[model samples]
Each structure stands twice: as C-alpha cells, then as structure tokens.
Target: MTAQRDMKEKNPWHMSGMVALAVIGVIALVTLVAVMVIQNMPLAQKYKYGIVLDAGSSHTTVFIYEWPAEKDNNTGRAEQKHSCDVKGPGISSYVGTPWKAGQTLRECMRQAEDNIPEKRRAETPLYLGATAGMRLLHMKNSSASEEVFRAVSDTLQTFPFSYQGARILSGQEEGAYGWVTVNYLDNRLKQGLRTTGALDLGGASTQISFVPQALDGGGSPGNSVTFRLYGNDYNLYTHSFLCYGKDQALRMALAHHTQSGPMAIKDPCFHPGYAATKAYSDLYDSPCVSDRKPQGAPESFLHTGIGNFQQCQDVVRTLFNFSQCKYSRCSFNGVYQPPLQGHFGAFSAYYYTMSFFNLTDTSIPLDTVKETIARFCATPWQQVKQENPGTKLKYLVEYCFAGAYLITLLTDGYNFTAETYADIKFIHKIKGSDAGWTLGYMLNLTNMIPAEAPDTPPLPYSGYVTIVTVTVFLLLALLLLVGRTFRPSCFKRSLII
Candidate 1:
C-alpha cells in the first residue's frame, strides 16, 4: 500500500512523456516528407531570347539563343535554339556589289524571324558581327566596307526584330569575346572558377587571348584589354594576327612561292595526284599577297597536291617572322603574347581542322599530330572527296593544308611548346552553341555580362528551409518537455479522483 501511494504521489510522468513523443514523432515524420517533396520541386521557368549573326569570311551563320528571363544574371543560361546558314557567301564577298550583301542575308534573317515567337520578336535583339573577312575588306577599301555594312544594316533594319547593328568586329574584340564565350559556357566565370584562354583560327585571321598575371610577355599596352565582370577585374592579353588565317596564309605562301612565268602552280600541300587551275588575279587581288606586279587579264594556274605535311608546314612558317622582338619576348611578327597558360579552348578553324583528322577528342602528343597529318596528307585528294561527298568541296580539298597550317601556327608562331600543346581543346561547340565569339558579342551588347554581383536574399532557399526545420524540431522537443513535466500532475489527480 505504501509503494502504490508513493508512485501515485510522484505522478505518472513516464506515460505522458511516451505518449507526447509518439505524437510528435508522427507529426514530424509527415512534415519532413512534405518538406522534402516541396523542396525538391523544380522552380518554375520563363525564357528570354537573343539572336546573333556570325559573318565569317567564307560563310554567314545565324544563331538564336534563349535563356530563363528571371535568371538573366545567372551566367551561361543563354543557349542556341536555332541556326541558319545563309545560302550565299559572307557579306565581305559582295564588295563589288555592296547592296547584294543585304540581299544575301534575307533568307537567313527570314528564318530567324519565323523561328522566334511573334510576341517576342519585337523585343529580341538581332546583332551582326563580321569577322576577319570584313576586317580585310575595311582595310583594302574602307568605302566598300562601309557600303557593305550599310547594306547589311539596312536589310537587318527591315526585319521585325530589333536590329541592334551590323559592324566589323576588330581582332581584339574577336579574341576577347571568344575568350568570354568559352569561359562563360564552361562555367569558369562563375563565383570561384578561373577563366580559360581562347584561341580562334578563322579563314582570314587568328586570335589569341587570355587573362595574364602582370602581363607576362612585355607586350605592348595596345595588346592588353581590361574587363570587369561579376565584380572581378581582369587584365587580358590579346593579339589578332591579321592575314594569318589559313586561307590567306595559303595565298601568302603561293604568292611567295609563285615563279616568274609559271601558268600552272605546283602546290606541295595537296596530294601528289591532285591538280587544279586557279585564276592568277584571284590570288593577287588580296592585300595579303605581297606580290605588287601590275594586274593583267585573269590567268589560270594549276593547283596540285604533293601531299607533304612537312613541306606544307614549311610554307606556313614563312608567314611568321620570328627574328625581331621589340619586347623582352615576342610571338612572330614582333607581336607580344603572354605565354599560353592554363587550358585553352581552340575553336572555329582549329576545331574544323583538328576534327577533320580525328585528333580533337583526346590530347595527342605533338609527334602524333605530325604523323597523323602526314598520313592524311598522303591520302589521295580523290579519296578524301569520295569519303565526304556531301561536304563543301572547298573544305574537303583544304583540310590537309589546314591541318599543317594549324599545327605550325600553334607551335612555331604562338610559342606553344610540346608541353602546352595538350592544353588546347579543339571544340566545335559548347552545349549545342557554336564555339565562337557570337554569344559573347551578344552578351556584351545586351548588357548581360554584368560588372557587379546581383542582389540576393539574406538567406538562400536551402538555408531558410534548414532553419525552419530546426526551429520546428526544437519547438516540438520543448513542448514534449513541458507537457511531460506538467501533465503527470493532472494525471495523478484524475486517477486518484
């Protein structure tokens, strides 16, 4: 009787505690599952659009990009949605009849218009950037360049979309934007990542750009370009080698090698079995040709391939002058370039040429590149054409020369040694967008490359959720403690009564 009385007086707190914990556990379990489900749900999405025109030397390509509207500040949301290649050549090709440049773009522009939604068309910005081809046009005949620019501009303005502008992009701008495109797409420009360098090889020019530590190469001030992105400052070293593009460089080689009285030209870069006759004037008319001989009626010359990769590299090497260095160190042609550091994104012709020989995906030794080039060069031109019948005949015929030229330019001209050769990543595209300067160009023009960090809430979504979860658990625990301490007294009285 004494033990029972003592137990009743002390109160049955254990039963209340057990019952309270059971209820709390059940409620907490349900709430946890519901919270996980809600938290895991994807955010609702909205999109915005942009369009860019890449006026390359050989062709014109139209790209349409889309990104989430609300997350414009988030890096790399923009993506290529559609691409249209103009039927005709680039605008620079219409220098003779400048107005025809506008007409050539009509088909592609129409495609862009049809692809975008009618409601979004008015707000979408359309930009056109002419690369090395236009740069050469501007240099040879500024008036002609302007007429072509104006013609393309007028045509773009006729469209329903907002015509931002049509202009020739400087080599520096090309290099910088190309770098920006790579880093942006690679997500290296995000909060804690380091940016990558960009190496762009075009038909008429090539560009090298990178962020350097203290401008390493004793380069000219003109070669340095400053950028402010995401609240970080970058001092970049860039150089655009005009007329060093594969096509013009080939022209330069032919001009240098042309004998005084040869109507048929023997090109060592081609397969030995290959032969062709190109108009002599077509080779001489370009500013890249050092030949200043008075012009005559267009004469044809035989273009045959000897298929010698080493010989081709020899010809390509003549384009660079390594002798003079006004600075402590210099790339060929007295141009200053910082040492090729970190990984590099080599796109455009770099990808085209490397991919042609299947050397792009893996990092191959320099000697292996040479061996592959040799084997490809040894392949008969007829076989190459037979293998890729549907490809543009021009690209098919020039891959051998392009391969040799690419390797030579990288190794000898840019000072990229065997150790750094593997750093080059020959990429055709990033996330379906062509690997080039167009996306970065659009980003800059549209003010999407921000110089400051975006304002964010004090607590992120995950943090808020975590805090709420912890607070809820703590409150449940406190309630259990209080209920267990006080409820037993009521139990004791009720049972006794």
Candidate 2:
C-alpha cells in the first residue's frame, strides 16, 4: 500500500500533462501575437504618380512626381521622380507650324511613359502649363496660340496618361504658384514658418512674390494674391512684369541703341571684338519693341561690341521707367510694390546666369559681384571663347549682358539695395525638384496637399513592433516561471527513476 501511494504521487502522466499545457499555452500566445502583428503590418509599398509639363518661354520640361499611394494627402510627400527637357524652343515658337509643337513632346512623353509603371499610367494625371512665352504669343496672335494648344492637347491625349488640357497660366497664377512650389518644397507651408519670397526670371517675363511684413491693402489690387494652404492663410504680394525677362530686356536694350538704324552699332553689353550681323526684322519682331522699330530701317545691321560694364548697366536701366508712379511705392514701369520681406529665391535665368558667372553665392558683397562681372565683360571675345571652348557661342556671348542686366534689374528695378542683396538665394533646384510653379500647379489641381493636417497613428510602427515583441517575451518568461513554481514532484521522481 505504501508503494502504491508513492507511485500515485510520482505519476509521470501528471507531470507530462502539466509540461504539455505550458508548451501549448506558450505556442498559442506566440501564434496570437504573430497573427496580430502580421494583420497590422503594412503591405508592400505602392506609389502613385503625377506629371507636369513646364512650358516656359525658353524651353519645355517634363517633370514626373510620385508619392505613396496610401498617403497622397500628406504634405511634402510628393517628390520629383524624373525630368526630361524637351529638345526645342517652347511651344510658342511653333505658332507658324503648330503641328511641330506636338512633335516636340514625343520623345519626352515616351520617356515619361517608360518611367511610370504601366498599371498606373492610365490613372496618372498629366498637365501642361505654359508660362510667359505663350502669354506673349497669345497677346500677339490668339489664333496661333489656340492652334498650338490644340496640337499640344492632341498629342498629350494620345498618351496613356490622364491628359489635362494645356493652357496658358496667368501672370499672377505663375507668380503665386511659383511661391507655393518654393515654400512647399522647403516644408515651410505646413510648419507655418516665415515664408520665403520667389523671384522667377524667365525669357519673356520676371515674377516677384512675397508676403510683406506689413500688409498693404492700399497697393494695386492686381498685384496681390491670397491662399489658404495647410490651414495657414497667406496674403502674397506677387507681380509678373512682361518683357522684363533677361531675353526680352536684352531686346529692349538693343532697340534703344539702334534707334537711328545705325548699320554698325557699338554695344557695351557684348564682349570686345564680338560682332554679328542681325536682321532688323528679327530684332523688332516682338511686341515689346515692335512700336519702337525705326521706319525704313535697313534689312540688317552690323552689331558690334565695345565691352563696358557701366554703359551696359546704363542701357539695361533704360528698360525700366522710374520716371513716375501713382502708388506710394513702385518697383518700375509705374507698377505698385510693397516693402520687400524675408529671404528670396531667385530661380530659372537668375540661377543660370549667376551660375555661369560663378556669382550665385550671395555671400559675396554686391560691389564684389559687380567687379567680377565687369572684369568678365572686359575680357576680349577671342579670349572668352578660348577659355570656354565647350560652351555654345550663343549662350557664351550673352553672359556679360545677362550679368549686367541681372544686377540692374534687382538693384534698380526691384529696389534691392546692397544691404539686402545677400537675402537672395540663386537656386535651380530644391531637394531634387526644380524650384518652379509646375509642382505647385499639379498639387493644386490634384488636391494632393490637404488644407488640414493629416491624422497620425498613436504609436509608430517600430514602437508597436518593439512593444509587441517585448510583451510576448515577457509573457513567455512569466509562464515558464509559474510552471517551475507550480511544477509537480512526480516530474523530478520520474527523471530519477
């Protein structure tokens, strides 16, 4: 009877049953934790895309932007994926042969098609926004502008993407959207940081946009733009001066010098020894200087260079009419302007021209910049060409003029003084995206940037995962400790037997 009782106490089945329960319980707990984690885990990441074509005065650029499919409304989430520069002048140049404008986009469209996934192409939105060049073309010939747009639209529609019709963005729209692009890329809009001003210098126009420290309700109504972005209200002072772009301004300067139809004119803007015969008709073709064209002018004129920086600046200043203003303040040409505020981003031609001169660094004193440009202008044309052999003669010869014009436009026209010059940042791109209006245009059209801030998860994914893992480990350890504490005496006896 004593042996039977001891055997009952030391039953191996009981010990084994207890051990089995602990193991099963641990397995079940682990399985349940894994199931919870697996169910909550994010799936493979997928992306959605948007395309914007920046059809500026000088050229056309196709920008491909993409964002996570699940987080389309998130601020600063959309980034530039790829960009292709169309190989031709802007679509406005194709007015006489509008069909050719459509052809210019083929290669770039093909590149965009290849870059975006086939499945997403159908839903991907594609938009084309023409800037100042088309504005000028539209002003000159509305019929031609319509034809060019029709041709461009027809070509864009042929692509698999969701084609939004091509249209000319207003001067105000151009400036405002450009401001949006700069601020958005910098993550300033969502954070409500002091906004940066935008200065876009294109071929046919220049835009200046900023939020003044003191709101001037008394200024010209046409110059003001208001926006509600990321729950922040912004009253922007923006103006686009037509025919003030570097290229058009250059034309105006040349027109001033050639008033008498002189066959051989000395141009201080060009490098010494530089000479080119240009047609009078070509010079006076644009609306900017067409009225100023001297009657009975010769078929062509012998354009010659004298290379004088002071003279060049003097000539550039003539383009701006500082003679009269009806407002309390004026930038130029009788245009109303409020007081300048905050840091400014000077892009497009501003960046390119300054970059070419190695004067993009605003830290350099204004006087030093002028000195460097003056020295560059004084360099003989032959020596200039020899030093920069790889550069195209067309762009190479114009550096001197562009530099002088840039300085004059900022200081004399926009009233940026020597003390305030450092505030301007000459930038081509910001965080991989070109600093321009296209991204903002797309964002506005697609409603990608929500007016309100997006909701966020209580715990980050990594934090949740770590907590779950730690919890599971702690639970298993506790179970093991309990099993040891409550373990049957039969398990030890069975081992000894």
Candidate 3:
C-alpha cells in the first residue's frame, strides 16, 4: 500500500512540466493567429485618418495620418500621422510670387507620397490650413497672393487622394487646434487641466485660446470658441492696441519722423559721397559715394544722406494717419495729424505690454506678461541695434511677437475668456519633428505672415481707444515715478546750494 501511494505522488509531479508547456504553447498559438488576422485586414479597416496643417508666414505644410485599426468589432483611432511640408514662399507673405506659394504644396504632396507605402496610401485623408502668411498677402503684391491661393486650391482638387477643405482657421481655431493637437498627443491635457489656454505667436499675428466648461453637465464633447481679428487673439479686452504689427509699426514710425516738402526731394549729405539727394540714400546702409560733382564726402550725421529715408518716412506717415483715422473715427477717409512725440517705438512697446495682459486668460500682473514679450523681442532688437547703431530701428522689439497678435485676435474676436479658454490645455511639444520644413529646413518654425484678404484693401482698423487708454495710464505712472525720484533729488540739491 505504501509503495502504491508513493507511485501516485510521483505521477502528479511528472505531469507538472508538461502542463506548463501546454499552457505556453496555447498562448503562442493565439498570438500567431492574431498576427495573421491583422496582416490580412484591409488598409481602410485597419486605420483612422488624422491630419494637421500649419500654413505659416514663410511656408505651408500638409499632414496626413492613418491610425491602426482596433481588434474585434470595436473601431480604433488613427495611428500617428505622417507630416509633409511644401517648401516655398508663404501665400500671404509680402515676398515671393503666387506660383512660388502653390509650388510649396505640390512639393509637400510629392514628398508625402514618397514616404507612404503605395498599398496603404489610398486610405489616408489630407488636411490643409493657411495661417498669417495667407492672411497678410496684401503686405506683398496682390496679384501674387491670389495666384498662391488659387494654386493651392487647384492642386488640392487635382490630387488623386481625398482632400478635406483647407482650414483657413480663425485666429481662435488656430489656438484651439494647436491646443487639441498638443494635448491629445501628450497625456497632460486631461480633466481639470483640459480647461487651459494657449498663446500662439505667428509672424504677423498672435493667437490665444482657452477651453470653457459647459454650462450644464450634459453639454457636448467639443468645447465652445470665440475669436477677434485685431492685433492678435490673446488679449481680447486690449486687442485694439496690438493691431499695428511689425510692418505697420515700422511704417508709422517712419511717417512721424520724416520731414516732408521740397526738402524731401533734395539730396542730403551722402556718406561715402553716394547721392547727396534724400531719394538715393541707402536704406540698408551701404558706403557708396554720392554722385555730387567733385565728389562730396558722406557726412557722419543722422538723416544726412538718406534721401529715400525721408520719402519712406512721408509714405509711412501718410499710412499711419490713414490707419489712425480708421481706428479712431472708424472713417475710411478722415483728416488727422501724426503724433509729435516721435516715440512710436515707446508707445508700441508700452501698448504691446498692456495687450499681453489683455490677451491672457488669467488676471496675472501686466509686468509679468510685459517681461515675457520684452524678453522674446529683445534678442532680435538687440541684434538690430548692435548691427547698425547709427540707423534708427524700425520695429519695437515686443511688437515682433506675432504669437501675441494671433492670441489677441482670437481672444477678442471670438470673445474667448479665461473661463472659456480653460477648456483647452497644452500637452507636450514635438521638437525637431515639425514636418513643416521639409526642403532641408528652408521653412523654419515660422508663424503666419498676416496679409489682407482678397478684395479687402485694408481691414477696418479698430482699437485705438485701448491704446490711448493704456498710454495714459503709462504716462501717469511715469510722471509719478519721476516726481518721487527727481523732485526729491532736486529739493536736496537746492537746499544745499
């Protein structure tokens, strides 16, 4: 009996290894079957489409995606998408012709086709968008801008693949889209954090967007949006002040500084004796001598040889008055004089600072926003200043932050507030991977180059009152600081004397 019991125990131990092997074998078999099924699935059945396009001031991009399909009957979202960039001039940039802009998209599509497998390519959908470059086409030659748009549209229609309508995203849509893309990619955009805001500084404008919670618990999945056109989308309340951009600001400054009259036509003292006349003075600061008889040497004084500088100034001034009139009186034609301070630079900086606060969803201190913008613009401004100390700089440093303009335009035009913006959140940033610069970095990470829309000569200027209001507050603060510091010093000196 004892021998029989021992035999039974040994038999159980013997089967243990076999049982383990059997389980593993079953698992392996199941995995192989699943792989085969996946391989056999149709491309459309296995993927979802997702795409994003960033049409910037300098370049445009077309992105397409095909996500992996889910197993079982349940559907799966699209896999990570492919990004293709068209390298050419932006449609709205004040440079390049229309043909160049259209070529950008075509090149991008060709590159994308090369990257995608022939078998799977048919399933992908393309998405296109145009940003500030297209918006600011008027800054350049108008005919070129139209051609650029037409080319892009025509190319999209001709492509064999399906094309979604190109999104000429509102400033708010741009902000929201960016927010969604980032957050969706990164897990950080969740729950409470979903209600966040973003600032997108482009070449010509800035955009700000925030998410808002639903009024009722049963509200829809997508968040509500608001937008404005002036300046940028950030500071809706102060959107008016930021309306003048880098180019516009330059024109205004030049206009106020120029001395108009027959003197404008006369050649001033040319440095290196290039041209004595104002019209021939070098804007880029060359050392060419004037054509004056006997070779008059260039003068070492400001405004001495810049004959063209005066004309540029006059034109700029005229434009500024025109812009100001549209802004202040809402009149297409109104009589006005330029400000006497010749401090458009200071005013521009100060106004932008205030607008930063105005654009943000939070009630953060104005100085903090000012500091951020100042830092962003300071680098380039410093370069300009260092490169040419003798010449006057055209743009204020802070005004260069196109993202601020986009933010403000979206915020004010859309009526997007902190509460509304809080719905969107930024997740993670993809660096060295923006598919927008495919022509070997020909297109850097540039934002929109704002241009006027087709048939729109000049968008009605608005928001002068905000600039004036902000300026007055700044003046008061300056006067107070001066009174506190200088008066005390002056009193002490007088008493001692």
Local distance difference test, each candidate: 0.80, 0.87, 0.38
lDDT of 2 by residue, 97-155 (tens): 99999999999999999999999899888999999899988888999999999999999
Model 3, span 360-406: residue lDDT tens: 32345333543554344334334535754654343322233333432
For residues 1-497, what per-residue lDDT tens digits would candidate 1 score against the true structure? Answer: 56556875565655675577667777776766766666666655546678899999989999998866644444436777999899888789998898898998888788888888898899888888899998888878999999999998988898898777887889999999888889888877656487889999988999999887668555388899887655567788888998988788878887766646366666768876898778777877787774553345337767777888888888888778998988777889988876667889999989878887889964688899889889888888888788888888878778888888888888898888888898888998888788889888766655643333344445578886896688588667867776767776667656766
* Sort by lDDT, top down from the best: 2, 1, 3
- What is the Cα-based lDDT of residue 140 in candidate 1? 88
TM-scores, one per candidate: 0.79, 0.86, 0.42
Backbone clash tally (model 1): 3
Error of 2 at 228 (Å): 1.3
For residue 13, what is the lDDT in candidate 3? 32
Question: Which wins on lDDT, candidate 1 or candidate 3?
Answer: 1
Report the CA-based lDDT of candidate 2 relative to the real structure. 0.87
The TM-score measured for candidate 1 stands at 0.79
RMSD of each: 8.0, 4.6, 28.9
